[model samples]
Structures are given as structure tokens and as C-alpha cells.
Target: MKVLVVEDERDISDSICQYLANEEFLCEAAYDYHSAMEKIHLYEYVCIILDITLPNGSGLDILKQLKDMQKAEGVIIISARNSLDDKIAGLKSGADDYLVKPFHLPELSARVAAIIRRRLFEGKNYITLDKLVLDIFKKTLKLDDIDIPLTRKEYELLLYFISNKNKVVTKESIVEHLWGSEMDLADSYNFIYSHIKNLRKKLIQAGSPDYIKVVYGMGYKFSIH
Candidate 1:
């Protein structure tokens, strides 16, 4: 999965990114409100960790913008402002969960996972589509009871495709979702093609029917038919 960590504290932001990366998630950081705003608009993250106190603006503004944009990304409010009003306001503004500062990173990760499960997998830990089964926590993909080993990008790409299965996803959207706001350095779509090819190879080797369909001159789609 991919996540954006919008925090002003350099240490906290880096720590969160490191931890999530260790957990096999691609994480991007946004130090200030403006950067976070641009990121939130450009990328489609599975989740976002927003700190209420930013160098340039309140995280509340970020939350409001998220709601206004009708973004489907799960949000977790991580703030030193632990007042009841702040929590209330965050929930009212559409945050999925709230974590006070000084909390454990593992707990935060769990909460994010829970939100993803509820939102995307119908609250199931294992996601099954036809003969393909994926255990989100175990980080395992199986086809007809056979295991499939996937690289980090390949795993994330499979998840992205499954999440938007049957929908025509544009290359731009794929790039943004996979790389976040820092994709300016990615001048070519070669890396994306490579990842998709690898992911398809793994699935087919595992005895699963290929479902990732390339839409010529457009993008790709995941479908059983």
C-alpha cells in the first residue's frame, strides 16, 4: 500500500516513513501544508497521516480539503492537540481515526490496516477474487493454494489493480498512486511497465488466470472476463 505522511516535525515524519517502509508500504512525506496540499491533490494514497500542527497551516485545513475533494483515502489524525474539541472536529470533518502524539508506531500501522480492510476488503483480512487469495497481514498471495512471491512494487501494483478491478485506470493515475508527489523524477513510464509485467508473470506462474489487461493507448484494467 501507499501512504502520505503530512507532518512538520522532521523526526516524526522520517520515523513514520521508515516504519511504514519496513512494513512493505511505500510512504511519501510532506513537511508543510502547501506540500501536503499538492500531494493530496496529485496522488491517490490508500491512507494519509495528517498532523494537526503544520509549519504553514493547520492539519484541519488539510482534512477539510480532503473532504471537499471527496477523496476516498483513509485518514488518521496524528496530532499533539489532543483536546476533545479537536478530536470531535476531526471526526466531524471526515477523519477515519485519530491518534494522539507519543503513540506507538505499530498501533498506528494497525489502525491504518484496519481502515483499509474495512474500506476496501469488506472488513476481511483475506481478499479473495476467484482463484486468487491474498492475506493482507501475512503478505501472502496464493492462487489455488499455491504461494506466489512478489516484490514490493509488484505486490502494491497487484493491490492497486485489484482495488480498481474492472475500471479503466489511466497511466497518470497509476504513476501518481505508485510514486506519490515525488514522481517528478520519474521521467519515463518504463518502470511502471516493468512492474506490471513482473506482477503478471508471478500471478501466471502461481497458476492464476491473468486478469490485468492493458488498454492500448489508454492504461490497464483488472477483470475476470
Candidate 2:
């Protein structure tokens, strides 16, 4: 999944991105308020790590904008000031969670995972789609209790499909979610097609139904109905 880290400090942002990258996320960084605004407007993320004190605006205002836009991305406020007022203010403004600065990176990752699990998988670590079962934390999938081997990209694609089940997810959005802004230079989505084809084949070979369906002139949808 994609995660946006809005922090003014280069070192902090770098560390956060590096850490989360290892945890299987395409991390995008915004150095200030303007960049954060632009990213939120242009892209969708699974979670956003926002700093309370920004270069030109308060993070609370950013949270407000998200609410105004009715974005579903979860927000976690990180602030240097450990004050009850700030926590309440951020929570009131619609932050899903808050963390004081000088926190451990593991704790940060755990919090991010929790928020994403709640947002994407409805707070479950495992997802069961009829005969198929996916363990989010273990990064494993099974069909009728038989292990289904999958490459990293295939697993991610399956997770993305299930996350937006029954909705048309465009090829462009899939590329962005998988590769982030770094894939701007790519010219085609052939790789995406190949991965999806292989994933669908594997699941079906493992005795699961063809859940991924192609939508002509649009993209694809994962549906049981």
C-alpha cells in the first residue's frame, strides 16, 4: 500500500520512508504544507503520517481539508508537543491516531499497520474470500487450506483487488499504488497485466473461483457476485 509522510525535517522523513519501505509500502514524502496539499489532491493513500507543525500551516488544517474532501485515507498526527489539548484537537479534527515525536520506528510501523488494517481489511489480520484465505501479517495465501505460492507483486495485486472488491480499479491507480511517483517514467502497464494474469491463474489453479473480472474500456474488478 501507499503511505504519505508529511514532515518538514528531511532526516525524519527519510528515516520514516526508509523504515516503511522495508515494511512493504510505497512511501511518498512531502516537505511542507504546500506539497502535502498537492499530494492529497492528486493521489490516494492508505495512510498519511502528518506532522502537527508544518512550515506554513497547522496539520490540523490539513486534516480538515481531508474531511472536507471526504477522503478515506487514515491520518496519524505526529507532534513534538505532548499536550492533551493538541491530542484532543487533532482527534476532534479527524485524525485516526496521534504520536508524540521521538518515537520508536517499530512503534510507528505498528501504528501504521493498525490503521491500514482497520481502513482496508476492516481491522482483520486475515481475510477470507470464500475458499481463499489471506493472512495479512504473514503475507501468505491459502486456497482450501492448501498453500498458494505467490511472488511479492502477485500478493500485493491480490491484496489490492480484495481491498477494492466489486469496484472498478483503474490500471493507472494500480500502477501508482504499486510503484508510486517513481514509476512516472514508465511508458506502459504491460507489467501490471502480466502480474494480474499470473495471480488469477495461480488462484484458479489452486481451486479458487475467477474472482478478478476485466471491465472493458475501464480496468478490473474483484467480485464474488
For lDDT, the strongest prediction is 2
TM-score against truth, every candidate: 0.93, 0.96
RMSD for each of the candidates: 1.6, 1.3
Report, for all candidates in order, the number of backbone clashes.
0, 0
What lDDT does the true structure give each of the candidates? 0.87, 0.92
Weakest 10 consecutive residues, lDDT, candidate 2? 179-188
lDDT of 2 at 69: 98
For candidate 1, list the clashing residue pairs, or say none.
none
Q: Residue-wise lDDT of candidate 2 within 47-84, one digit each (tens)?
A: 99999899998898999999999999999999898999
- Give one digit per residue, the lDDT tens place, for model 1 in 59-173: 8889888888999999999988889999999989889999999999999989988998889888899988888898989888888888888877778788888888899998787
Predicted structure 2, TM vs. truth: 0.96
Q: What C-alpha lDDT does candidate 1 achieve relative to the native structure? A: 0.87
